[model samples]
Target: MKILITGANGQLGQEVSRLIPDASRPGRNEMDMADPGAVGRTLDEIQPDLIFNCAAMTDVDGCEKDRNSAYMINSVSPSVIAQYCIKTGARVVHFSTDYVFDGTRGMYTEEDAPDPVNYYGLSKILGDFAVIPLSNSLIIRTSGVFGEKMNFPLFVYTSLRDGKEINAIESSYSPVNAANLARASVEVERKGLSGILNIAGDRISRYEMALGIARFFGMDESLVRKGNKIPGGIARRPFDSSLDISRATKLLDWDFHSLESNISRLDVH
Candidate 1:
């Protein structure tokens, strides 16, 4: 099947590209989702059977600074793309976030109501809402995703290599790893499963993840200090964003790897 992958350079996009044998990767130059006309033109030209849309304005802080850009990329663009997919009879695999939940509950289910606390989360939730009603779309909500092209893993690697102290949140929590999330998305598309699924890793806090990585590198875990969220920050993250993947297990019939396994699989540079 002819497949189209948006955000071909992103963490999840790259992984999804690798997962597909020969995906049609559309870079920003070819089809910038931020540009409405460009998205339509690309959809018309490619006419792909499956479209894996991994592009987004993911910088939570940056999104706060540019809410218009975030909304355009996260919600408006995807909704427009979904409308095009509906016309083209293309199945869509849309990447989303666990931030859709407000975090009052520790483990979220697929049926949970979305109450995003920030502009970034709110935009993603809008995209999720837009896609669910049309076309064969699979919405995968994940959190703290780390990968070769990710910022989080790079921060961890740089801090250790530079011998600088690192700080992580002991209170906040979620599962993470871009490659694992991408793999799950590929499997969902390959299986033609359509619904909301949580592509999360073994749940743990940022502090625990740091300690685990430090341990992996034989570094001093003490260098990784636990920190709390800044008071009155623009984004209000859920203290615990762990998602229950029982539905994913039942529907996808594939077991997700543990956080330790995810770290072990990383290149770590």
Candidate 2:
């Protein structure tokens, strides 16, 4: 099958690229998601039967500072891609986040309403809505995705391994392995699952997650400190953006991973 994976350099994108080695993996220069026209042209050229839209301006604080760029890349261009998928009868899997919820309560189901607390979440919500109308498109809402790139787990692992101190926040989230998330996405897409699905690992606090990383990496867990809030951040982070993956769990036949299991499977060099 002709496949296309955008945001090839990102954490989830990197994992997806590794799984689908022969897929067309494009960097921003090849198809800048911020530019809808460019994305449309590139999609036309590739004519992919399956597309993984993993591209997004994910930095919550950064998205707050630059709302225009966030909306353009996160939602507007995705709308264009969805339109193309509808026209070409292609399948698409767009990744969303747990931040779409206000975080007032935890264990959010797919049927829950989205009350985004920040611009980043609002932007992703728009992207999710854009793809919802497409019959062949699927939206996967995940949380705290981590990989070898610049992510929460990697940061914790490096800091502890280097004997550097870490003041992790107490915010709760469901940390998912990007590799495993990619695999799960493929499974659901193959199963003809459409609409929204939550695919994430066990829910845990950021500080506890840091300690787990230290233990998994054989580092001093004492080096990690618990912090209350992000230092001087523009965006307001949801205290608990944990998603309920019950649907995905059943669809995946209880193959969902937990924090400890995902850490055990880490293949860092």
Best by TM-score: 2
lDDT of 2 by residue, 20-65 (tens): 8999998899899889999999999999999999999999999999
What TM-score goes with each of the models? 0.92, 0.94
What tens digits encode model 1's per-residue C-alpha lDDT throughout 144-166?
77777646556776687679998
Off by over 4 Å in 2: none
**CA lDDT, candidate 2, residue 122:** 97
Which candidate number maximizes lDDT? 2
Q: Among all windows of ten consecutive residues in candidate 1, which has the lowest summed lDDT?
A: 228-237
Task: Name the TM-score of candidate 1.
Answer: 0.92
Give candidate 1's error at residue 69 in angstroms. Answer: 1.3
